[model samples]
Target chain A: MSQENTAAKAAPGVEKKEKPERDIHNLGSSFIFKPNVIDDIHVKAELGRYRMRGFSLFKKIPHFDDLTFLPGTLTRFVIEGYREKCETKTILGPRAKRPMELDIPVYITGMSFGALSYEAKTALARGATMAGSATCSGEGGMIPDERRYSEKWFYQLIQSRYGFNPHHARLADAIEFFIGQGCKVGMGGHLMGQKVTDQVAEMRSLPAGIDQRSPARHPDWLGPDDLALKVEEVREATNWEIPIQLKLGAARVYDDVRMAAKCEPDCIYIDGMEGGTGAGPHLATEDTGVPGIAAIRQARKALDDVGKTGEISLIYAGGIRNGADLAKAIALGADAVAIGHAALIALNCNKDIEEADFPNEMGVEAGYCYHCHTGRCPVGVTTQDPQLRKRLNPDEAAERVYNFLHTLAVECQLFARACAKTNVHSLEPEDLAALTMEASSMAQVPMAGSQHTVGRPDMTRY
Target chain B: MAELESRDSHDMGMHDEQLAGRTQQIFFKPSAEENFTYPGAYEVDFDKETEFDAADMSNKDVNLKIRDLMSQGYGSITIRNPGAKHSLGVCILNRLQLTFDGSLGYFGCGLIDGPNVHIKGRVGWSCAENMMAGTVVIEKNAGSTFGAALRGGDLVCKGDVGSRSGIDMKGGTIIVGGKTGMNSGFMMQRGRMVILGDAGQNLGDSMYDGTIYIAGKYESLGVDAVESEMTQTDIDWLEKKLSIYGLKAPNGVENVRKIVSGKKLWNYDNLEPSEKKLIL
Candidate 1:
């Protein structure tokens, strides 16, 4: 989160410019009390409740952009950029009998059907299939088409158990136990009444048009010990075939992950504070969990400590925008990455399409809109309205999602090959160097021009 | 590495029945037709009865044996000395008459769609969790979270059940002949829970849309749960449901207390501006 700094110097032939005259009447403004902050207080005072929105955290954090790849130079031999093979094929939950194999290391994360339109959900399913990746039936249960279109599918057993069906679960390639989400660490999911149509209501077995507030705790099991027994139940149900993954929000990463490992899940998914939500409290989104850079490091260390590194796979999600982010995650210790907001962007989430009147309909310009909670998405990706939904063509959207996923995989390969790693999974922490001290400390990687990592004792001992 | 068995919608029977309009996914194209042909679902005969002992077998072996028997058309099956095995008799989707002479550990009879199951002994936590359409009956005391997230069919426990029983129950009839522990019917959405004996604290807490009928006194009510006037319809349902399991309320069905959601928490921001501002 370092701000850009530049110093001004006058040319030899030009005269130096004078500083602008300060207004004597002005006592000057408080940098701490910025206009946006003041406006937020005012809005809250009026609303009498916390503001809710659909997007990733607005505040900046130490992120993938702060970490730069130090690819092969003189010491190591580089693989050919495009010609040589850089294996993007990834496997998660290797210990499971039927491990989830992906052609690419990235897959679309779960976003519930009630929070999104049918077209958007199916399009993602079809797209992920085409990309040889996977799609998760997020919360409100499995839509038939989403299941039919997806080659590899994850059935999420969220706390709410909304529309959670064993028939649908039995059809899954894997099961995701939604213990928590990154966007709202300890909170449950929220789908505004606007989007809770009759179809969604029936699926979740709730009254339609009622604001759906999912429970944070699972109805059956309460703790990790019970979770172990619950895992056994699912394993027995699935005939011990598909993998069972526990998706945990990034909080007390080391301890939480250690406990999760004890539960004996095939995979552990860590969702960072930077993760986007279809709808969530703005405060929770900005302030809840640790950032991805830090979360992955702790999670990996926890797995290593537990002697389950190879047996239990780690999948990281939150604030991943492009290939470099995906590659950086793997280097930091993630076996794979999951993308939600980025995939939505690829599905024309904020695009200024022909049918979209963004400013008029959403009260913002195309790129500025984050109104998925409103169920009035101008681009049709997050809406249930038939007219708005028609704005998105599932066929084209599916292709775009495929293209986006493909580009990310290829881009991730570019970094891997440059780093002289034939396999994308071979991109290790040694290939990365942090541009900022926060990144250096959090990611536990060295600074850009130095061998010194901020938090490592050896660097300070000297 | 091994072949996966197919689990169909209750029956391998609903051929060509569209996933009903319940999904509200009307934009489905003819090309991407919903395929209901779950290839590996079994067709069994009820008259073909068999019994086995699962005293020494692992959960995987026991479940596999049951499925194998079903595949071979042995529909009415019994397992003796189940030995309090966890996850026993799970995810049985076919219409079979299954019985267990002994007790089951946690998650017994869970995720089942169509089965008439009887457990002669007690059951542990989360028994019959997410059962779609089935009759799961326990003769003795049941543990916590009994029938959690139950979707349909009849689930009965003649003896007392622990806390959070029927938590998040969707559509089903849970008739507990004995007392129930705290938070019974917590967050219940759609269903009828009939607790004939004394109900514990926080009865029918935070329910969305459901009815709870308790013949005895409830220690306390949880948030948004309130008592309502019992009608003839409630009496009829209680009487009919109780009779099926040969359960009679100590007090008459008409004297049973009814609890339902107050609809206050249903739409949190239904107060002022956008209802979307749920802080979760």
Candidate 2:
């Protein structure tokens, strides 16, 4: 080839690299980051982007109307901080004399070593410690520094067990046997072999480039009875000194909770349909599992039915944000809550920043970028790039985590006070009245405490 | 008694010695914290460094019934021939500590868990299933599905593994010095599986994902799975793991292939050839 021709071939976007071209299902990276892209199809309209569509027979209409909160009655007076005083000090895990102790309800969820950077895992532990709560290390065993943070750690033992140090066998404060995650139930986790570093490969104990796969059901367990037996095995190992926890995706909440209660674990954690992941097939995320609300309500009722109401604490996750959400969750019978995406928000992940070496035009911004499917987290929160990881200081990030938790607690406290409830658990459905029929009925709150009005509160207590 | 006395002073005194009680009183007590008891009426103290004298001790549920009586917070425990005359049948299910130096070793095994579990003989498959911690060393080969769904622990085999070794393995390390039959690392999610010898064909076939590393010649790689490029990160990782397994830096290891499943497909269809190449 001539020099001129070679120069043309080497030009930026033009290269000889042959990308496997296909017209197969293009779930591609398109929907991975953007929300509701499934509904945004481009179609011809009479009046395009400018004017109202001229020939359109149907127009977009608001789905609901006039939602309002119930006003306080004379018997139930609102306290200070109509701007401030509600309390949200909810406890997760049965503190009912269980051998294990977890100080905060809001804890970090599980993220595997292969899925995240070692730096990210360490940072999560640091942040959880800073926040005065626990961060979970995934099945990849205990990295040395991770073990150092064991005081504030919840070790999630996945199917592919790694980081298991015999000397540190008794270290974990709690044990969580990951069943089905909200993202994908019954499907195995896959870390693209290309991404598997030798360390990652070694940690997983596989041939260098071969894909790693976990079985759908536990090898020894076939059903709930088997699961309980396994739970007993763990209990025996720890001498019943640490609380055992079971984490499951919200697929069949009633059945799942029922089975979990049989094992008598200290807590049952539920992650809903919208659970986030570093990477997962699009079909699994969008098409699988029930939503968080249905799962939580069904599970709570299941617990009550089985006479295990206070036996196992219930924690709900999947797309939670702010004080109101926390209150709604508690009102729905959740003992506490877990935060994944919201935690990322607190850490300011996916930020919009201008840099010389930008990869794409659609700049990443906090809360909007779900580009974690690729290992390139531009904002340094999710990527494995050493330089980027250095940008985040665990100590500082951990402080932010602490601050966020502290602030959320204050807000919860304020709400509890407003409803005349001294404790968070005391602020019940009786104190809550939703503005929308959807929320009121879904939350099972007795609207108006009377009839016919979703937002109206019964003033008889007045 | 007079005839016994004429044989020898020692022999005459043997009956007297028996009357004198050579063995210490082995009292069995209930665990102060629990409602359970040792159940069986036999006890052996290793401090006498006594070789285990029991011929059929393996079939009993030891961890659930007798483990507490042996606790002294010591570093090592060796049980000789516990299963020599009996089928262990879930007796030592979760009681081996082969990895931790201060562990309880059951000499003969049908099933075991935790502590440096050195099996001087063969172990039944599922020997280390769902083991949360410890080491299981099998001097002989294991049956099918060994270390299946193993969460945390180490399983080191001195001999070949039967079919489906490390199947659906989530987390933990399984090192087989000899060759592994078919279905090794099948449906592996997370964790490293090091196979020193040649692997049977379709090593990770139908596998949705996870990593697999083989150091021998491959008759055939899995479907939708292709060779991945070995980056510097991969090199460093290989070196570290090699050092861990007491092997050299893997700088000149022969036929070291990195087989990878691509990012696209949920199972096998999307596995594309990787860009990096393994020199060895």
Candidate 3:
């Protein structure tokens, strides 16, 4: 390290110190206002509006990695991984005459037809059906092909009611009343003008070539009392044969879940801040809703308080990536877990395929792309454009999705067997230890190598 | 600033050519197929009249009986004492003459495609919601959220209707013989609403695309909802619609104030450089 070499390797903003002991005019950097913060400010100042993007949270929070499962030893007996059966059967909305039954404990959450191209939507439906899982008809309504390929499907009755039809609703195995989602809570959905094609526009009954900002409130029902009637109306329309699930964003989970239970839905789904969206204000995604670890616990507690625990099922979605995350969610009391972004990833969202030039096309590297809002998805998962859509082969993508979903179930079973649980639903909170204090408090689990749980009145008596 | 403007697709390296029939197969094309096969398209005879008393039966029993009747080719059906049960006569996708002799509850006759329904008594909220092609006539007063998300056909209430009538209406016509509650036709996309009597506050608020004719006084206009000049064509249509429903506007049809969208909130116009689409 000669002085000349040091000067060449120094970053652009660095003030080269001539003397080793000199402290004059030397001020440390800001944690709040980093270089990225300045970059955000500069962009907003130029744009005059909140910047929009498609992805989940950009900032790190206490996540599943902080919770480690405690395998069995002398105190507990471990079920043999290779021979024994770890039942992955999951049932949602059991109160209905025909509950939504799944071979695995995981399903693909709704991601609307307008946000994703035809190939991507159908491929997802086919893959989930192969895995004996379910898929939802997100916001802008159902793609006919997606329905044809899917075995079990949920028709979402969103607040916007974009493309909602009773004829279509009757075709579903279940009905989901989408009140809100985790990524951008308290806001309606967003479909930029670029993605609102002629067909998509017709499906949603909106004008073409316009930024379709959906209404956040339901046009029919105004309050919980009204919602109760609305739910009854749907049940009657479905001949009381299918289950009805309420999907809400994770905010004030305990109170929200209690109110949701009062609505008399067969199932309640809470989406955490880790949920991804096709398009939304970037700030909303970063600063809205609680994490999954905390949301599930509060939701489960709320159901218990209302004495609707077994009568009503709880499903959690948001930031769920792998088998470990699935096991952790089930352990935290979620009967089933739903995934969105990870499913799209399996459909080749951010892949640097030979058909795509990620750096040149997306203005970012393949792994760093978060530009689904612009409808220029490099790997063809989100775009409606014909050329970009061609990049994703549905046959190959469907197989990949099935493989990924199959892998997730196996991995979750692995943990269940190691924890001396013969059934995936039997994974309990007692088997997990929190590595961080924030995680310990949020998940309500004891700290690693200690009997104390953070935020509890009796911290030492877990 | 000009150099930084990546407004068009070419700036972001997206292709401009519209590749036809290449990337997407049959399902992607708008003109290809409807995708879903509509269920319960039963054939029935109009002369085969049937009347059922639903006083002692639950809502399910009545609905199932209606299905059984429809499957047996009975088109002219009447139900006595519907008990104002919610979700009565829902998802009827065929043409039939249906009659409710008593007042109905919420979501009555919803999601019907082609049916001529007559309700002799007053109805609760959200009657005839999302009706594709049918005529739902309530002789008495109707509750709030009347004819919500209605797509096609006509929804007529001889008496007053509650708030948020025709909210998110995609198509069809809503005719209120008397006064209506506030925020009627909120966020309405496409449809025609005729208010014969007074309207509550915020009439036609934030409506995307629709025509609202208010014959009587209104409390106030909402965001992006502005009054427009009434044409002779509008007068003729109102006169015909009123005649068909056997209701008269207090004043003549020519005096009704026509309201439409101001077209101000449709587009923000500040497209991020990448949002500008050059690709079709």
Candidate 4:
């Protein structure tokens, strides 16, 4: 038999059908071949041709969902929900002369006045006061209204030196030296000309309708030793009455935490990958910094390595949503948790607008809004426009924030009760378990239903 | 140092003991004078004057003592034999006058709100940094980042200043008697910098709304820093600032080169890519 005839005869009843070429338009793999629509729109279309505007890039990344709490069942005893009392109060910077004592472990992270409306800032302060927590004055100068409403306030000494006044520094309960933020780790803050109103310009001492770009690093100091001296300067400036906190983004978390601890700050504040910003470069927000879970683990380890675990307080920010997240952070060794995007949400950020004009008035649907940098927010929480800002009444918005904080505290207490912990701080890494191997390795905790830890060898002993 | 010891203990009766006791027990305030001497207090006598040294104590202790004295409203402190100590006379709230008789270290008189600090010798980095509504006079040379991030005050460096002098200055007058190192008045938003001697390269780099008056030879200027005609108003302002520090202009007003913000780099909307590079 001929070779071709023999081959065809060997595979009896097999059809010789030719396969068509694969389509390039719809590649099955989303990550490798296809271009991300969001990234293309922002990088290629918007910022590619013009100056960068203020808008945070939203992307899906690994977060707190990978971890889960191992509730008490047979080996551990869970407290009765009805009769037991779980403490939610937390103290920060206990080594300092005047440590910040909070009724609840949750605090409002720094969000500047240039970024948010005056009403929104006041509302945050009032809400934090009602919750017996603290609110921070962000990059911009401290507003009088916010100070009037807030019981305890943290003042940020950012690199820009915008609206930085000695009077405000002295007035703050604690001073936070803002080294970097999570949204844009190595980059500085940007406020577009549209957002620079007369009030904003006056506060920052900049020209009206001018784009303000803050320096990425401080002009005064460079290295960790220099930072230590600067910390001394701030301590002296506040008469050593208020605690000094070093705020850093979660990039090189272990090294950054170590350096910040060496500066002898009373507290170290770490902002992770999921932290929100008023505005930032699209590339920076999407592809920079470590996640909050991983950051907390490294920060705790760094503090422990330096033998300053409890000596210096650790405040964690980024993607902290509710009481469960707060409980998880505390368990990972955070003295307190700060909320930014969630606080704005509590102030009606993405809520449905019931006005008659509705979508037409804002030029966008309520639920799909993320135009905080435009200075024309429909919800009035992020806008500086007088008309838009009027929509957010400080008193009413404050009540919502209060309710949100109350709910978080209650939820945290419930979690503590489940773990049979008397205080929220008593929840340790042993009480947590990871749902995935990635999370188990990063958090150094045992995988679900397994006695072996993913990264550490002797975590079972913990 | 011996003059400080000869002062009568009875003369140190300015602060009431009860008020001092109450203030000391409060947050961040120094406790009652049990072991050490309160430098600013007139009635309080030191247990061992020779042993008390600001260099030996922490910046917290030094500042707390200064603040305690300032809290009494108004007073004078004579820090004798101060050897380059950081954060001397920092955050003095009231109109207390601090006289440093020797060299000081980094952040000396930093964030001075209302105090008048006189340093008789040279200072280390960031002397009078972020000073607000106060007067800081460095009798000799100042280290790098001198008067950095100054908000509202007068900082007079009688001698040369290091690099990045008067950086990010807002609403203040910084007078440098001798030469200034690189990037003087860099990113200065508002204020006036008067340089009596020569300037290093990148002078007034990226200055937004400040004025720079150089009476000596000028090196290369930074982007957005332009030489404008010196006006009578500029001369008058310079004279006023110099008079406060008991200084005289090294050169005539005609010889002075007045540098101001070009206002071209204020907004990036109209600027070309090349122009942006020039300012950035």
Candidate 5:
């Protein structure tokens, strides 16, 4: 009996008479309740809450890859890449005096001095200056090194007003009123006590060893109208010499852009849902905000609807990786684009670091690490510890960032040449076609191999 | 004083010119060759009769005009019939004395570094928001968000103030003589607020490090705000502030209640499980 049973059980295709009972205690894997879902349930059950901390959003949302450029073919002549000169120069905030002119259309987005190491911040400034672009002063305030290094800088006005000073405001080339970020639209900025080093505390005007939670909204202004007043105040403060920019997360893009335009800002910056942050609520980062493609399209439409098409500049950010993404963003009507996570990656973040180098309590490896909020970044991109931060030499990191930016511009020129555009800003929606219906609808472009656009009615068919 | 007399006659002549539809008035014109330098002062008098309209001129032009007058070495200026024009006196970086005879609109005297701004009438929202230093005195009621995000300054409001007053104030002294609207001193990091009148609800909500002195009744206190004993040092400071603003305390110093941050709401982990709902 044992030999026959064993032979039957061992057979590859045979079923034994007494089959192993399904493990009822461990419920079978369910598509509806995935592993992460189950794990989240357990976490909530143990913690008695759903507090989004440390991790970013995990859900995959719509992105720019859904669309493809319709390069010039037989009907149109594609410019020769090596022989032709494709312009990448960009001008921002032309409506105001002292508009920022850059040699390239790509810029370094804001990363606060507190959130990133001093070396990382300096590296970004140096790299941006070398690349003939601008770097932004993120949340806390403008550091001396960054201000001295960056030729052109955009100072961010976060809700918390941490380290905000009028003297610094006057020194900036432009001021950006940070309404929200892509990763956490409705949430405030969070800096754990561990990251609040003495320098960070001084910069933010807070006591050391205290956690900081920036307010979600501006303290004085509540809505768009109030924002208009605040903008006027800032304009008066600057003597109308510098441009003013309004930045927002990509949610309700059309309405927000319209409101922001009415406020008469020189530029509007929209960050898509795929944006990264030092720390954010997991659910907010994942579940909230629209993608870059949709945001750019809607922002353009809003500007057009408000009769502010060329009167105000539009800047796009979030998940912009390379030259192709830059070209696509410009084609979708963004005057310029900003880089964050990609720039960090170029600076050697989450790379070339051994697991042993990481703090033992972190329990993470190089490629899968995201402990920026803990102030224990092994690669030193987001740490405050002197020893850890020393690992990233600003000179070397600046060279890498400069190379990355240079390569991105070169790649963008190639795309622009193939699209038969002399200037990157001249690239239009007509040069693009959507590969999927969702993208076609959002982008208002015709589907590939189809005569009809998704959102608009086809008069030819009618 | 003789210059003042000459200026008075010039102002009258400008008023007649204004009636003749020649409304543009350049009090102290700067030559193109002149190089403007700081640490100077101004004493130009802007009046409605002269048609020196803050509303019609660009902020740049007004600021430039102010700068020019200051560069000419005038130390004090008086404005009459302000009529609530927005941004009347902004970005003045000198140590001048600006006196407004009438009500001003939004952002009046905003971002002044060293100027002593005196508003005789009510002010619009954000009277001195994000102001760095110097003194801002409002004789009447103030709109919402009065003295918001003030880093280092002295703001004295003689009458009632609207909601969210002293919000996000980093380092400053705010003295309110009358009733205050809701959410006063919210998220204040390091500052001193002296309220001699009744205070609205949610006083000192989420404040990090600050001292609030209230002599009158308060509606409610926000999370992490609690009353503490009023020490003698607080009374002396209050007295000094009252004297600076030329105000009498509404009640005895013994009646003033001192409020400070409880330090319990600084971290989320410090909150009790039941208190988590308050944050959410």
Candidate 6:
């Protein structure tokens, strides 16, 4: 078959004929493909996975504007190569007043241990720690192996309530009580039986091969008040030493944040509907939860209304890709941001193992194929296959994580410089303007300048 | 309207007689006194087609009224399309106290320990769906899979329960007055399902360590249930049970087909031998 015909048939309509065929490598397949000939093949954003054939066309779009950095003005200047350019040290502990403590603002978002191999969890913890950031354990419990790499670790107390590790008292820096994750709010997680290795099966207390069904609601506590009590129980169990944060998907976030505030939690991190998952049910990932930008605004309002604004730090996650998002979130009153799928990419997941035709033998195009719930992750990050996992070298992956964190920090500094600000927190609505009118209104920030200023921002809230 | 329905000759003669028999058999006569009594107890008066508006009821009064309502033994008081825009929020009434008063029969929600219950009448899926004391019985044969995950309590069906009655009962007894469609005790761990009539296909399919006694013939017994030794103790238990249900034990009580297995479906770690025998 002609290469063009084969490419067309491989993922119909997603790719078009190109002139200067570029050499493309994946699992076992090798082919020459031209980027431009493929209609609309301008995807330049090199972050995130592109799983289904449907999104490959968008992959052709370019991401960076020639590594654009913010220009330094007299007000704010960039200080590089100085012995003391800026102190990079941060203190994170569970007992601090700000309950949800973290070494760096960047943290590992929730990705189930069951969805990932033991090595993946270890690598994440190891990588996150190496990067001076914290890693949050997903619904899965605090595995002993993962504990070794834990310096600043957040344990997700999922609704499933699996893996109540005794050392959770000691190893955990903070207890993140997950009310509803953004990807699947008002739903339970479905860990297919095939993924349940003997170890995973024992940890989750389910049969080795029977599909595990997390209850739709919590087994013990039923409502917000009950969750408050459970939070108290954890506090007492940990001798009032640990700070508790409540994490919930951003759907009906108005009420959710209100309830979280009522619970008197130290931090409320909202995961926008766009949150990434190693593998969520198709319906949930595609259609559930509110977008992140709006969630942050709602959460901020909720906390402000209760006069608990600074008392509980607000963090937002879901589909956050670049420093611009970081800037927008802070302007929306989010204290920090957490990332999941991005962290995985930094760990070098979804990469072609041997530089072959496809990303992996699974015919998964690349990053988008995070259907790890099937236990057949073409790349090692999301699978239990020891051989596949071997392809992922933790040390190298750890460096990548460190590099990604460093890059994100640099980008933050650049944005701060542009807005004539020093600390990220210093960037306010007045300093920055959104690109879109809708974004400007939703963010409660002004447009580019006074010329486009329509009304006092307080009068409108989308 | 309810009074008129109760007086209807056809409804009275057939349904009332059957209910009376069932009541005598299930409740151990001189039954528990009607414990609950309150105004606006039943939303739907037995004969009335229209249901009582749950909105009219304050949450405070819902439980109390439902408690009293269940005692009236209305055959099929349905909370039609619950969890809908115009449906009553879940209300539980403890053990339906009323028997076949006829009036087209009452006997709805019996022994509601606590569950948002909505009964579509002529109900027959184990009056309780894994009822831990809560019950919702239907006057008609529950199609099948009644008491599938019955945890506790009694779900007495007035009509034939179609197949797989008490399929995976952990605790509780489902006494089907008529017949069991099939696979009656599929994986019943710790419960007794007394089927009064013929049982359908693969009855007690691979049933592990539970007692399913069918008064009539069983079409097929599944992978687990082999014949078990029916001892004198078994006969004695059957006789006592049948007498309560107002039925004499089948002739030659000494000879009865019993299906038994020690295998447990849930805990695969524990597997025991199967002993099937006709004990005299």
Per model, state how many residue pairs clash: 1, 70, 1, 3, 2, 50
Instruction: Tell me the whole-model lDDT of each prediction, alpha carbons only.
Output: 0.89, 0.56, 0.88, 0.79, 0.80, 0.56
**Whose DockQ is greatest here?**
1
lDDT of 5 by residue, A1-462 (tens): 688876756667665578778887995679989898898889877675445454345676556788788889887789898678888888899978799888899999988988898779877877787788889999999776577657889999989888886778877899999999888887788887878888788778787778788899898789988889889888877778788999999999999999999999999999988788887666777788888899999999999999998889999999898999998999999999999988998888878555335446357666677777888877788878877886786767877887888888888888888988888888888888888888887777778777667767661110
Alpha-carbon deviation at B83 in model 2, angstroms: 11
Task: After superposing candidate 4 on the true structure, give the runs of residues whose Cα lies further than 4 Å from its correct spot.
Answer: A1-57, A356-363, A456-462, B1-61, B71-75
* Residue A74 alpha-carbon offset, candidate 4, angstroms: 0.7
In candidate 1, what are the lDDT values of residues B1-280, reduced to their tens digit?
A: 0000132222222233232112223332333335645423578899999999998898779999999999999989999999989999999988999999999999999989899999999999999999999799999989999999999999999999999999999999898989999999999999989998988898988899899999999999988888999988888878888888999999788899999988878877655454333222
Give the per-residue lDDT digits (tens) of candidate 2, residues B161-207: 77677776656678776778776766655566767677887676544
Tens-digit lDDT track of model 2 for A1-462: 799887556667665677689869775675354544433323213212111100001211111121123435587776665554344444545543444444555677777766666555655665666555677777656654544543456777565554443234456677777787776666656555444556666665555554345445555445676567556555555545667888888887898898889877888888777566665655566667766655677788888888887768888876566666665566567787777766665654654544312336225334356665444665556555555555554545555666776666666656666666656666555665545555555454544545443333552221
Q: What is the DockQ (computed on Cα atoms) for candidate 2? A: 0.06
- Sort every candidate by lDDT, greatest first: 1, 3, 5, 4, 6, 2
lDDT of 4 by residue, B1-280 (tens): 1221332223322123222111212222222222222232233222212213565666667667655554444366777767887877776655666788889888888876766778899999988788778788889999999998898878999999999998988878899999999988888889889899999999988888889899897688887889998888887877777887888777665577899988777776566655656643
| Clash pairs, model 4 backbone | B12-B42, B12-B43, B13-B43
TM-score of each: 0.92, 0.63, 0.90, 0.86, 0.88, 0.54
lDDT of 4 by residue, A1-462 (tens): 788887656465778656798887974656643566655666555332333433344677667788788878888799876568888787888877888888999999999988998778977887887788889999888876566557788999998888887777867889999999887898788787778888788888787777777888787897899999999888777656678999999999999999899999999999998888877666678889988888998999999999998899999999888888988988888888999999998998878856314367656677666667677777788777877876776667877888898888888878877888878889888888888877887777788888767766675622
**Candidate 1: regions farther than 4 A off:** A1-25, A460-462, B1-33, B272-280
lDDT of 3 by residue, B1-280 (tens): 1211222223322233232211333323333344466666678898999999999987778878888899999999999999898778988888899999999988888878898999999899899988999899999999999998899999999999999998999999999999999999898899899999999998888788989999999999877789999999999999999999899988889899998986665766554555433111
> Candidate 4 DockQ score?
0.20
TM-score of chain B of 4: 0.78
Tens-place lDDT per residue, model 1, A1-462, is 233322365556888778999899999899999999999999988877778899889898999999999999898899999999999998999989999999999999999998888879987987888788999999999888688768889999999999888877878999999999888999999999999888888889999999888899999999999999999999988879899999999999999999999999999999999999989888988889999999999999999999999999999999999999999999999999999999999999989998889989989998998889999999889988878987887767887998999999999999999999999999988899999999999999989889899988896311
- DockQ for every model, please: 0.34, 0.06, 0.25, 0.20, 0.19, 0.02
Model 6 misplaced stretches (Cα beyond 4 Å): A1-101, A355-360, A450-462, B1-280
Candidate 4 docking band: incorrect
Alpha-carbon error at B124 in model 1, in Å? Answer: 0.7
Weakest 10 consecutive residues of candidate 4 chain A by summed lDDT: A46-55
lDDT by residue (B1-280, candidate 6, tens digit) is 1221232223212223221000212212212232113222244344422233443443324333444455454423333222211112222423233322111111123223433333334542223433455434444566555665565665666567766677656566667667777667765556677766677887776554567766678888776576667778878987775555455434444654666654544332122323222110
Top-scoring candidate (lDDT):
1
